[model samples]
Every structure is written in structure tokens, then in C-alpha cells.
Target: MKKQSYGMKWLSVEVVVILVGLLFLAPFYFVLTNSFKGFAELLVDTSGLPKSLSWDNYARAWEVLNFPRAFLNSLLITLFSALCMVVAASMAAYRLLRHPSRINRVLFSLFVAAMVVPFQAIMIPLVQVGNWLQFLNSIPGIIFCYTGLGVSFSIFLYHGFMKSIPLEVEEAAVMDGCNPYGIFWRIVFPLLKPMTITVIVLQSLWMWNDFLLPLLVLQKPELQTIQLATNTLFGQYLKQWDLALAALVMGIVPILTFFLVLQKHVIQGITAGAVKG
Candidate 1:
């Protein structure tokens, strides 16, 4: 009777979880289904599926948004920023570990503190600095901004994960005549793979989806990221709902596909990162 009772409890939990999952997925269903609909049909019944599957909205959005260019811009910015953040954060974290100092403590504390300080607090000053540095309206400009914004949290994650790494392995590598650089790249970095993947996934998502920073930095339409391009569909008076929805669906598909592909790695990375922190 106890065994049967446990089985029934587990089944109930599973059913509840399935229902919640469907509930969360409901918005995605509406967006996807309505993306195929005309403005009129969508207004009539958004909850219902499209009367007829049509790619008209998608085609219009694609042309107006200049999806190809925006996609390339977003991809470049995300990949570059993610790569830089991973390398710089991992190295900074490792160095702090290797050479523990009062300064290192202060630095780590600053990084941690920065995580709590909202971006809005610093955005105005950041923009001023960017302008002074001549980093405005350029890909390199926004990439630099992303690096600064992402690096703090990345360092925190890497630092925590670094704590779980056995120091003796690095010591062994050093004793074998490996220089500091070689010791880090060859021995230590490979071990940081899980956390590194986590950082990459996180930074990529942030940079790819980020609109505000890119908007402030890259003002030119030619250099617009996907988010910026999508925002153009929203006029002051009349919003293009069909085009906007289609663009949203388009934007969502790429990241969703990316996450699905690397979801296992992401899960493993998060688990491994949490184990140390």
C-alpha cells in the first residue's frame, strides 16, 4: 500500500509539472500561431491557430528588418563578446587564485559588488565614457560595452569554480618547468571547461538579446543588431503587430535552437559551477 501510494504521488507530481510546462509554453504557441495570421485574423482571435498558414508577415518583416544584416551583426557581437569575457574572466579568476593578495580581495569584492549595481545606475556615465573613447556607433564599441558588463559576473563564476579545482595540479605543472602562461593554458584552463561553457552560454545570451546598450552605442541603422532592427517596427503612433510578432518569432528561433543544441552542456556547466559556489 505504501509503494502504491508513492507511485500515485509521483504520478500526480509529474502531471502537475506537465501542466505547468504547457502553461508556460502557451505564450510561445500564441506567438508562433499568430505569426502566420493576418492583422485582422490576429485581432479577432489571438488564442486560435491561424486560419491559413501564410509566410507574408515573415517575408515583410525579413525585408523591412534587413534580417540578414542584423543577424550577422548580432552574431558577431555576441560571439566576440562571449569569447573575450570567457578568456579574460578565466584568466583574472585564475590569477587571483594563484597570487592571493589584499588587492586581489578588493578586486574580487569590486566584481561581486558590480553584479549588484544595476546597469541603469552606470549607463549614463558609461555612455559618456564611450563617447570620450570614440567607441560610439561602432561594432567594437558595443562589444567593449558587453565585455565590461559581462566580465564582472563571469569573473565571479570563474572565481568560485576555481576554488573547487585542486591547486596541486597547477603546482605539478609549474614544477615541470611550465611557465605561468603555459601552466594556465595547458593544465588549468582545460579543467575550467565546464564553467567556461557556462560563461559563454550566459554572455552569448545577454549580448544577443541586449537592446538598450546596442541602441545607445550603435545608432546607425546599418550597424543595428537584431533587437534594434526589431524595435524599428514599433512606430510612435501605429505598431506593426504582424511584422513585430514575426520578427520576435524569428529572433526567438535562433537562440532557442542554440540553447536546445547546447542545453546538455549548459545544464552540466550550471551543475558544476554550483558545486563549487
Candidate 2:
């Protein structure tokens, strides 16, 4: 009777979880169905599928949003920032682990503390510094900003994961006549694959979806990221829902495709990284 009761409880929990998942996905379902719709048909019945499949909305939105340029801009910023963030944080973490000191502990504490400090509190000072440095409205400027903001969290993750890695392997590499740089890049960095993939996935999502920072830094039309370009579709009184929904769908597809392609790696990375330090 106890075994039967436990099985019944498990089934109920699974049903509830499936229902919640469906509820969370309802918005995406609406976006997908309405993206192919005309303005008239969308207003008539948003809950239903489009009367007929159409590409007009997507084509128009693509041209207006300058999809190619926006996509390229987002891609560059995300890739550059993630690469720098991973390399710097991983190295820093490895160094702290290999040679722990009072100063190193204090610095790691500061990085962890900085993560809880709200970005809003630093926005004004950050913008002021950016202006003074003439870093406003530039790709390199925003990429720099993303790297700074992402470093703390990335370091924290790396520090924990690196602790879990046995130090004996690194010591063996040193005995084999590997230099410090060679030991880190060829031996240590490769072993950090799981955490590196985790950091890349997390940072890419933030950098790609980030709107406010890009909005502040990128004023030129040519430099606008995908989110900024999409914002242009909104007006004070009227919204181009048909075009807006189409743009949203287009925006989601690329990231969705990215996640789908790397999903196995993402899962493995997160699972492995979660193993205790």
C-alpha cells in the first residue's frame, strides 16, 4: 500500500509539472501563431492560428529592423565578451586556487560581494566614466562594459569549479616541463570545458537579450543591436502588432536554434559544474 501511494504521488507531481510547463509556454505559442498573421486577422482573433500562412510581416520587419546588421552586432558583442570573460575569469580562478593568499581571498570576496550590488546603483557613475573616456555609442565600448559586468559572476563559478579539480594533475604537468602559460592553456583550460561552456551559455543569453545597456551606449542606427532595432517598431500611441510579433518570432528563432544545437553541452556543463567544490 505504501509503494502504491508513493507511485500515485509521483504521477500527480508529474501531471502538475507538465501543466505548469504548458502554461509557461502559452506566450510562445501565441507569438508563433500570430507572427504569420496580417494586422486585420491578428486583431480579429489573437488566440487562433492565422487564417493563412504569410511571409509579408516577417519580410517587412526584417527590412525595417535591419536584421542583418543587428544580428551581426549582437553576435560580435556576445562572442567577444564571452571569450574575454571566460579566459580572464578562468585564469584568475586558477591562479587563486594554485596560490591562495590573504589578498587573494579578500579579492575573491569582493567579487562575490559585487555580484549582489545592484547595477542601477552604479549606472550613473558608469555612464559618466564612459562619457569622460569617449567610449559612448561604440561597439568596443559596450563589449567592454559587458565583460566588466560579467567577470565577477564568471569568476565565482570558475573559482568553485576549479577547486573541485584535483591539483595533482597541474603539478604533474609542471614536472613534465610545461611552462606556466602552457600548463594553463594546454592542460588546465581544456579541463575547464564544463564550466567554460556554462559561463558562455549564461553570458550569451544576458548579452543577447540585454536592452537597457545597449540602448544607453548605442545611439547610432548602424550600431544598434537586435533588441534596440526591435524597439523602433513601438510608437507612443500605436503599436504595429503584426510586424512586432513577427520581429519577436524572428528574434527568438536564432537563440532558440543556438540553444537547441548546444543543449547537450549546456546540460552536461551545468550538471558537471554543479558537482561540489
lDDT of candidate 2 over 63-151, digit per residue (tens): 98999999999999999999999988999988877788999999999999999998889888888899998878998998899999999
Q: CA lDDT of 262 in candidate 2? A: 78
Give lDDT: candidate 2, residue 168: 88
Q: State candidate 2's TM-score.
A: 0.97
Against the reference, the lDDT scores of all candidates come to: 0.89, 0.89
RMSD of each: 1.4, 1.2
* Candidate 2 Cα errors over 4 Å, as ranges: none
Name the weakest run of 10 consecutive residues (lDDT summed) in model 1: 268-277
Per-residue CA lDDT of candidate 1, range 165-199, in tens? Answer: 78889889888899999988999899988888888
lDDT of 1 at 6: 100
